[model samples]
Target: MIEILELTELPRAKAAGALVADILQTMRSRAAVGTNLLDIDEWTKAMIVEAGAESCYVDYAPSFGRGPFGHYICTSVNDAVLHGRPHDYTLADGDLLSLDLAVSLGGLVADSAISFVVGDARPAESLAMIDATERALSAGIAAAGPGARIGDISHAIGSVLGEAGYPINTEFGGHGVGSTMHQDPHVSNKGRPGRGYKLRPGLLLALEPWVMADTAELVTDTDGWTLKSATGCRTAHSEHTIAITEDGAEILTLPNHS
Candidate 1:
């Protein structure tokens, strides 16, 4: 289902987006070496409750995932890229951590993700992977606007990641968000420009570009949720929710402190 926010709903969308961004930033700051993954989930739950926001992930039962996510946030580590279920694991130095979150505030929803290195150890390959995703995300956002097509954004994102030498995976990419966490108008990471859905004002899209270091193939963890690289190499993911407006695409998930 595709949703176009009315002018009155934009404020609520902004609020939800800001809350999502703030919570992710807070989690990133609190995540450190030896921090348990469960602790991160707990922190996310507390913050969501404090904000009076509902988690889109908790109790989420999608076809691809096992029923009921049963978690407040997605904590993807190292080889893990998407749908990472929190487990009884402690983070260690040099671990690449990706956190994806979506929440509803005032009946509007926003989603975002960020990947960063934990602790003081930043491996070169991991840093490069993270950088490529971030750059690709930026390119995608730049390609979005009131009249731009979804393919334009995809092409822009794919160009960066492909140039950086990471294979693109289309099985899971970005999507629309509004009254619910996931909506219609699937936005792939790579596509031909001038094709696909045409953008319109008030449309909200979550554009995420993720890549594994050496392979486009993914393997599901025994938990039945976490998606990891087939080669078990490091990976990174970056995402942001944006709203198409008359002027251009307005990024709603930028860090509040930034």
Candidate 2:
């Protein structure tokens, strides 16, 4: 459903966004070379409960995924890109890790994701992929504002990734977030400008730009959740929840801590 939040509800949205940002930053610090994926999940759960917030992912059961995600956060590693279900694997040096999180606080929801290398070993290809997604995310946010078309944001994002030489995958990109995790206005990674839904004040959109190393195709893991590159190449994803405002698009999921 398309939800246009009232100004009165914006404070709650900001609080939710702050909580998501804090949690993601904390998780990034804790994810090390030997850390277990399940351990990260536990850490996320503890923080969510401590903050008196709810996890949007724990009960998320979309048609494309297995019912009830049953996890507090998504831990995608190396080749895994989206809907990465935490498993019994330990992270290794140079592994590209992506953490995607969504949380509800004060009756509002915000979502975000970040990709980084695990330990002391930073692979050039992995770092490049992460940089491309991050740059694309910034471009998308820059194109967002009241009266702007969703296609404008999509086109901006696609340009960055395309110039970086990564294939755009439209199967999943960004979406609206509000009282619930996912909402209307599916934002593609690539599209024509001046088309699709027009942006308006009070609208919250999670603009994510993700790409596989060399292909646009994705394959689901046997676990029925984790989506990885069809070619088994590395991947990266970056995202932020933004609010369309009179001045411009305000990023809600920026880390509050230094």
Candidate 3:
């Protein structure tokens, strides 16, 4: 369902965004060379409860995923790009890690993702992948505003990824997010501008731009949660929940410390 939030709801959205941003920052800081992915999930769980917030992922049962995500956050390491369920593996140096989180606070929801290398790792390829996703996310948000169409955002994001020589995947992309984690108005990573839903004030969207290094295909892990690249290529994902306003699109989930 599409939820066009009222102007007053924006503050609640920011609260939710802050909670998500703060938790992600905390988790990334605590993550070390030997930290396990499951541990990160546990840490996030405590913070969510402490904030009096609810996890949108734990009970998330979408058609594309198995019912009840059964995790507090998504921990994608290296080849694992999207929906990386917390497991028993410990992180190693130079591992490209991605954390995707969403929560509901004050009856509003916010989502965000961050990709970083663990420990003192300086892999050029990994950094480039993360940079590309961040750049694509910026392009998408820049194209969003009142009266702007969803396609415009998609086109802007796609152009960035295409220019970087990465293939676009439409199977899973950005979507409306508000009172709930996932909502209507699926915003593909690639599309034609002025061909889809028109933007309006009070509308919130999570414009995520993710890509695999060598292919657009994704494979589900045995856990029925983690989505990895078909070619086992490294991947990266960047996202932010944005609200359309009179001035332009306002990003709600930027890191509080950044």
How well is each residue in 70-165 modelled by candidate 1, as lDDT tens digits?
999999999999999999999999999999999999999999999999999869999999999999999999999988999999999999999999
- Stretches off by above 4 angstroms in model 3 are none
Which candidate leads the pack in lDDT?
2
Return whichever of 2 and 3 wins on lDDT: 2
Q: Where does candidate 2 have its weakest 10-residue lDDT segment?
A: 249-258
lDDT of each structure? 0.94, 0.95, 0.93
Least well predicted 10-residue stretch by lDDT in candidate 1:
249-258
lDDT of 1: 0.94
Q: Count the clashes in each prediction.
A: 0, 0, 0
Q: Write the per-residue lDDT of candidate 3 for residues 110-200, one digit (tens) a residue.
A: 9999999999979998899899999999999999999999999999999999999999899999999887788899999999988899999
- Residue 91 lDDT, candidate 1, scale 0-100: 96
Q: TM-score of every model? A: 0.99, 0.99, 0.98
Over 113-188, each residue of candidate 2 has an lDDT whose tens digit, in order, gives: 9999999997999999999999999999999999999999999999999999999899899999999988999999
Clashing pairs in 1: none
Residue 185 C-alpha lDDT in model 3? 93
User: Model 3 TM-score?
Assistant: 0.98
